[model samples]
Target chain A: MTDSITISIDGVEIPAETHHTILEAADKAGIYIPRLCAYPGLKPNGSCRVCTVLVNGRPQTACTTPVMKGMVIQNETPELKRLRSNLIEMLFVEGNHYCMFCEKSGNCELQGMAYRLGIKTPHFPYLEPKREIDATHPDVLIDHNRCIFCGRCIQASKTFDGKNVFQYIGRTRNKKVGVNADDGLGETDFAATDRAAQVCPVGAILKKRVGFKIPIGKRIYDRSPIGSEIEVQPKDAGSAQ
Target chain B: MANVATNGKRIVISPVTRVEGHGKVTILLDDDNKVTQARLHIVEFRGFERFVQGRPFWEIPVLVQRLCGICPVSHHLAAAKAMDRIVGGEKLTPTAEKIRRLMHYGQTLQSHALHFFHLVSPDLLFGFDADPEIRNVIGVARKFPELAVQGVMMRKYGQELIKATAGKKIHGTGAIPGGVNKNLSIEERDGFLKDLPQIVQWARSALKLAKEYTSEHLKELADFGTFESNHLCLVGPSGELDLYHGNLRAIDAGGKTIFDQVDYQNYIDYIAEEVKSWSYMKFPFIKSLGPENGWYRVGPLARINACTFIDTPEAEAARQEFKALTGGKPNAMTMAYHWARMIELLHAAEKIQTLLHDPDLQGTDLVVKGERRYETVGLVEAPRGTLFHHYEVNEHDQVTRCNLIVSTTNNNTPMNRAVEKVARDYLSGTTITEGLLNRVEVAIRAYDPCLSCATHAMGQMPLAVELRDRRGELLDRRAKGVDAR
Candidate 1:
């Protein structure tokens, strides 16, 4: 068996594997790191920049940058908080994200992250772009105006279904996600049977025909995060990799 | 064409590049012009069908939505539709149905837009040899800034609409089996309506530009030679073109309906899927026939030809324009696929506007709540073509069997045939050129097949497949390359 390495996160010394990142080690030790584009199943994109943490006095995305031996990582530094707050603010203003009317209100990752970071008022001005609602299919809707282009859906489409259905169309601020060539989801060779939809971290791509099946109180994830519902024994609590 | 004999050996194109999903092409030719064997192999498998076997039936839509990012809504709807069938539920409320149509239109608009502008446009507008470095939409942004911006804006509008209407964008939780999960607020409806005219204008201008480009390069596109094959798509009850909800129809090369008005539930009876040892992708064909004899095509080109008329005025006009260019109803010419896509875009925009104006959209009850019955199936036309999701559940409402047939699978037979024909035409007579191969690949990409959704669950890294000869020779290999372009 390989020997474990020790690292201090927020003053707690935790045993970690040699290849573990500061975020991974800290997460293993019951530390929470806010993230959006860092799903366990998909490759870490680190585009959201919400999981930034102080590693050796510098801020970096915990999902991408790996850990070093004897590293002093600060997940809750003032600088880190300000950076995270700024990132969240940018995300809010970059798209037409009105959370109050959103069905994913209490359960949304973006809203939850914002609340955790204590974003009382959006520092940036609202950028309400002229957007269209594609509700052609009986099950899903796609709203590009509110998209952050985190590429989670794209990754999900490509990685899981082996379909390169969702692709990054443009670049930089002009960047957006769409079905290849702006085809309706119905026209793409995508099946309703693949599992890519469950992994989307935002509300950019949605079910079309069945938008409000259950009341707010009966939502599956309304009471707890997906992680919270699954029990974690001490032996099975480490990195899922 | 090259007369090289196979000697009973297989000629394989591993990791068939540029097409959607992971697959390969294998061919076995006898000494004569008669082809002995051809297989379009789906090389990667993640067992998505098997994985969903024991999960809760209500979670089928959510789980299956993760199957393909491009067409999650199709899967979501298909799963929901299937569940609705099982539960013996009434149809969704008028408002909910309208909202559903609007969302479906959004996905169609954005997805078709992406196919034309991003995936296939680069090859057409820039020329195949323009520059590998500048072959993507990003390069188009630099070369033709206005068009690129329009494309981005159009895509953003579709995706944004999806997020707003569905609550979450990619894997939205809005759609349940009986109906939708949320209603469009008056403000939201107004917001969507305000943007309709601009989108319509943008779509029209884009279509004009695309036509101009096509006319300029007519020689190259025409010289590509149109292939003849059967076309399959869905048609609405009013004899108008439809994608979301419709019965299946297969039309022959001569523009005659071969198989008309088939029910979605009887899909398995008409269509059959055959798996090849060389590839993981399965070739779906007309049942009771051999691979070579059962070829069929779907998606924009196929859908346009399969339908008699489009409902929306702008789309109908666009369709006329497409017919003018193709010298008949657009059938097998891949170039016309772009035009067909634009027509769908116009229709999508118009449909969205129409839905937004409906007064019932402001109603509170988006869902028709009920208990679920055991087995169900959902059917919808994805951008690429027909999509179906069937689920069987136990008494506890857990899925016992989940079978999915996606659009790519529908096109598998025709796509493999197209690749072989292109390969023989472009590679046989002369030395193989990268440009020619690229064009061949572009021809396949025009359909925008989604193998991933047909094969696995979301988030698994695509495993590259390579093929070697009997002597252990490397014929072709696809490395895990980055999407740098």
Candidate 2:
């Protein structure tokens, strides 16, 4: 038997399961908590602090923190909105995300979050760090310029695909996602059909020869905002439909 | 910079203004203060061709648009056309081709309007000798309020058309490798239809103004920078004027056909680029004629001279009157670019109106693909002149090689020729006057060159004049929009 609990989010009390994280609970009740590093069915790493919210008067990542009975969470406050926006802006400046020409532009989660948060232009000065590109893979390519280090592929490959193909290589500012083999993604047993290939939230790790397959208006994010799938239709309502 | 040591004097114009990108002019004179050599130098360098390597071929149409803010649509379409060939989708569906054509006509209309009213009007209305402070768009507004407003509205209408067809005014994703991304909505079509008549009327008025200005100053304008040169442009299958898709055509000053109906994909066989150490922009000329006599003029003047006739009624009438000025020969008068540009403006307006009424725009079939190829070339007539985009893609769909011959680059030699002619005709003595400096600018302005597209750079600087003696010592320095000593 699963334990049931109730939580207060932005002054609205919603019933949730004990195992549900703050993001999962809020999503169940059709309340959108903006996030980037978190995805459906993937374990949350909380690497990106975009989903940071005040849980019981303390800032915590909503995607990693579990829901408790009668706990008060602040998600849509002005202060929290500003913090989330700042985090999103930092992610943008730290990477060379040329959204205009990127293949994943209309479908990219980072770009979608920017659109949802109304970030016409980032306030911070761009770092414009030089990055490397590994296109040796016959079926896949990685462009480090657009990588946000979300760790979704890292988790998805290991847990879902049952393969340990990706890992974090460097430390601190020099850190980047490294392949399991020495040569590049080509040396690894990473196929384009792997679950990891479908989990990238950005254009960093892409399957070759499949870019811009969808037109402008029919893209994933073009139909709706990033979190509208959760906000517009609740879990119960979506199941009933 | 120039070799002032060998010359008697050198006049350095650090930057040219009222143009799209950054450029400088250095006029070297003999001991008697006679102009001997003049070169237009492209100061800024953006290695766009090198940067484009290793990028995905499909992303090129949108990526190359970053080349120029003023004429991005030209790059977008040209790159898309090349990619279409790479994907073996060169035979675009009627709907896709028409939509792209609509976008192109909008670009020409808006770019021409902006250049004529905002950039060149002050020179034409106030005369070349007018005060520098009062000779600009602001002066035009203060003197001719109604005309200024018309210019603004005309430009705005063209922008709306671009937004409707291309998806946005900047960085549009409407055009793709195989075809365009969207069809014109009925609502968008009706919205443009509402303003079509007013836009056509403004285009006619602008044409009349340019024609009257040319006629009033015919004798003086003839001697300004007049010279015999070859003309180049793209002509339709039947020798009609077509800006979007056509075959290559070149005509000599005496109306002799140099090349007609040559396929642009084999442009290398007919045309070649020559590099000079003094300028970053390459000089493009006809291969058979050699670099000396092969240098030709492009843009509006070239189009008017190369095409047999325009399909539209009003622009054809205007073209007929324009041709009569040169007795049906190629018009070599440099200032006549303004008049030819207005005739194109009218033609672009007429194209937009006709395309709006075509039901093919609302058709659903947008893209098509076939067996793939690796290397391809695409060409289109931009607002300035013919633009070329060539790419070689690998099996992985990554671009292996890239090359671009922008319109302004094709006109590099001719621009230098015009600068030298103006320098010899108007410039005399050691002292530099504002009116005399403006005469040189007026000659370059006739071409409406976009140095940014030619040099692949972004920043533009002001025009400065520096007169130095044979010893290379700076004597007098005067700059437009800059402090003068």
Candidate 3:
């Protein structure tokens, strides 16, 4: 007999592994709770709360929270949906999400989530924060204006490439992505093939000498909306339909 | 950024139509109801200069190219040329130079096709007063299906050339600091050559159509936004028409060469940029003449006017007839820009065939690697006009300081002057008509300014055409989007 526990997500009773988190169980059950900073290989940072759900009558980051037996987890409630969408909107206003000007427009996970949430415009005013570009690397460019602080590059670099080419420096308000080198990206061995370079969900870190290689309308997310594949629909999911 | 001397009534055309990026047209009227100053304001602030500070020198070409989607290749090449100087290889390998030249011609063909057929063709074809609804590409297809299809096909071939040379059509990242990333594949080269006949025919037909249309409307075509002013452009070593790259030249309104063969890196020695408080766009003027007298024009008309000859056969033939339009002297008429654009398109096509026949373009050695250097200046003639990308990097090869003199910024003063002239001719009183607004936009559009590439700041009011009174009260505001017409 398989060791499993019955967990009630929204109204459906589903079987899950003993130690699986709500997000992992939900994924196994073909559900997408809209996540960032929680890639499959990396340790969950739970910084971007796009996957916040109601667990035992309280809000928790689904990536970190374990699935409890008979916990009555609410994955797709109206209140949870609003909370997740508001978080996405906040992320947009906080950074420079110039979708029309951005190279990562259609393929962007953040943009995809916005489309999935039916967000044509953010509720909050654009921050338009001044950011710098690090073009010191020979084969890549880091546009800080579009960084969303997902820590994917940090995790991916350390986990996948066995390097710490990127790291989050400073605290709230004065924080930014810092390169490993003291002078700049030029002093680092950051190749275009690095996993850290490829992990950017936005246009923040882009491979040099390959922009617009894909025409405008023929990109990854251009043909269809984001998150349609491998996304098992929750019968009670809110507003996605 | 010119100051308006007028006092009372004001007409503001915010978010001007049929141009790349956000811009504003403001006409200040005096107490006598005559025009005082009309200024074109470039609102968006990309701040590529500030943001590119910490990046490595090699990344300049790719990053700076993002400044404009329509003319990324120009930025890409300019940055590469600057980097070339830093490497002490300002002159690249023969093969590399030929490939770069070919890529530039591709850019010219695509950009001119887009500008002529997509942006301003309707006004030239159906009159400036054509319905706003049909003043776009869709309308072009509806009115002249063959011309519209040709335009699309021209753009397609141009895009195919870009894709074959670099990687993609819109913002291909082919040109690097030293040279290109790769040589043209056999398939890509053969495919482009196969369509040579069709491309040449279209260029010829475009010249004919533009000539007929321009001659028929000679009255308005000559008088519309036409002015005698100093012109500036890049010319070949022997004064043949050079678009991709060349030393800068200046000519006075009377068609006499004022300055010739001045290298671009030394532009600051002869050229000076003046900052205005009212606008983010800086006015670039000749250092000797000062701001008021030094303001000059650049672009297709200015290039055709300033150049002594066109190297290509078909374009040269077209150029002769165009030069005859003004008794062999440089024609200052702004409407003639379309004709000059077509002529250049023919030249570019001819140049394309020459480049394709050259075996040098197929050489295996592309980028020439060398020790990194501190600073370099790159200059290229964008389809709109001249563009400069200057950068100073640290010992670690990180860019520390930067300066960019884009073509639109170079035209800011003349563009404002053109607006003022049009406002004086069109605006009668405080009441502004749709025709007046359209004409003002038409005058500004003659420069074909790309505000997105020129300026980068984002959050601004959506373009509005507002009529304000003496007391600073908004009198009338138009609708937004397609209904703005």
Top model number, DockQ: 2
Candidates' DockQ values? 0.11, 0.44, 0.11
Q: What does candidate 1 score on TM?
A: 0.65
Error of 2 at B259 (Å): 1.7
When just chain B is superposed on the true chain B, each candidate scores a TM-score of 0.88, 0.95, 0.93
Q: What ranking emerges by TM-score with the best candidate at the front?
A: 2, 3, 1
Which tens-of-lDDT digit does each residue in A77-119 have in candidate 1?
7878898889988888878776633445555677766776889
At residue B65, give the lDDT of candidate 2.
92
Residue-by-residue lDDT tens digits, candidate 3, B292-330? 899888889889999989999888888999989889888
| Colliding pairs, model 2 | none
Least accurate stretch of 10 residues (summed lDDT) in model 3 chain B? B1-10
On TM-score, the candidate that comes out on top is: 2
User: Considering TM-score, which of the candidate structures 1 and 3 is the better prediction for this target?
Assistant: 3
Docking class of 1: incorrect
Query: Best-fitting candidate, measured by lDDT?
Result: 2
lDDT of 1 by residue, B13-118 (tens): 2233444565544333434332333345565677878867644466677677777787677777777778766656537788777777777888888887777777
Fnat per candidate, as a fraction, reads 0.24, 0.27, 0.11
